[model samples]
Target: MTFEHAKCPLCLDQIAERSRLPDRGYQYQCPACGGPFEVSALAQRRAGKVGIHPGARAKMQQHLLDGKRPRVVFVNTTPNSYYEVREVNASEQTIIN
Candidate 1:
C-alpha cells in the first residue's frame, strides 16, 4: 500500500499509474480491461484473489459506456468479502473504499 504503484486487482493487468484517493485506496486505468477502477490497498495486494465478481466487472463496463466510472468498493475481509459497485459522476470526486 505504501508503494507508489500497483496493478489492476481484478485482471492482473499493469496499471501504468495510480492516484491516491481520499479513502486511501488507489485508482487507475487497466490497459487490458479498458477501464478505470478503484481498490483498497489490501485488495490490490490480494490481486485477483480478492474475488471481484464477474457481474461487477460487467457493471463496470456498463458504467464506462455511460460515460461514468464504476465506483468499486472492494471489501475483502474474511467472512464478508464482496464488491459494491456504484456510478460516479465525472465532475464529482470519487470516494473510493
Candidate 2:
C-alpha cells in the first residue's frame, strides 16, 4: 500500500545503503541500533484480495473466447496449452491453439 523509506528497526534512521534495503516486506535493520525494522501488511489494505471486480470475470471469459488469452494464466507463469468451448445444440467445438 504505502512505501516509506527503509528504516532501521533499532534506531529508526533512513537506510541509505543499497545492501540493507528490504526486497519486499518492511523488515530491515536500524542503521543506528542494528535492530530489525518491519513493515506490516496489516497496516494497509492489500490489493485485489477481497474479490474480483463486478463484471470482470465475465469480461475475462469473453476476452478468452475472443482468442486474447494472456501469455500467463492463474498464479503460474506457464502458458495455457489449450482452450475449448463447445456448443451443445450445434454439436461444435472451438479450440484455440
Question: How accurate locally, in lDDT, is each candidate?
Answer: 0.62, 0.28
Q: What would the per-residue lDDT of candidate 1 be over residues 1-97, giving only the tens digit for each residue? A: 2334556555655664567776646777666665666656655554555456777767766776676776666676788877667776567555322
**Quick one: best TM-score, which candidate?**
1
lDDT at residue 89 of model 2 (Cα atoms): 21
Tell how far residue 95 is off in model 1, in angstroms: 13
Residue-pair clashes, model 2? 4
What digit string (tens of lDDT, one per residue) describes model 2 on residues 7-81? Answer: 332222456221211232233323443323222232111212433222333443353455443111122136632
Highest lDDT, which number? 1
- Distance from true location, Cα of 53 in model 1, Å: 2.2
- CA displacement after TM-score superposition, residue 85 of candidate 1 (Å): 0.5
Off by over 4 Å in 2: 1-48, 70-97
User: TM-score for every candidate vs. truth?
Assistant: 0.59, 0.23
Q: Could you tell me which 10 consecutive residues in candidate 1 have the lowest summed lDDT?
A: 1-10
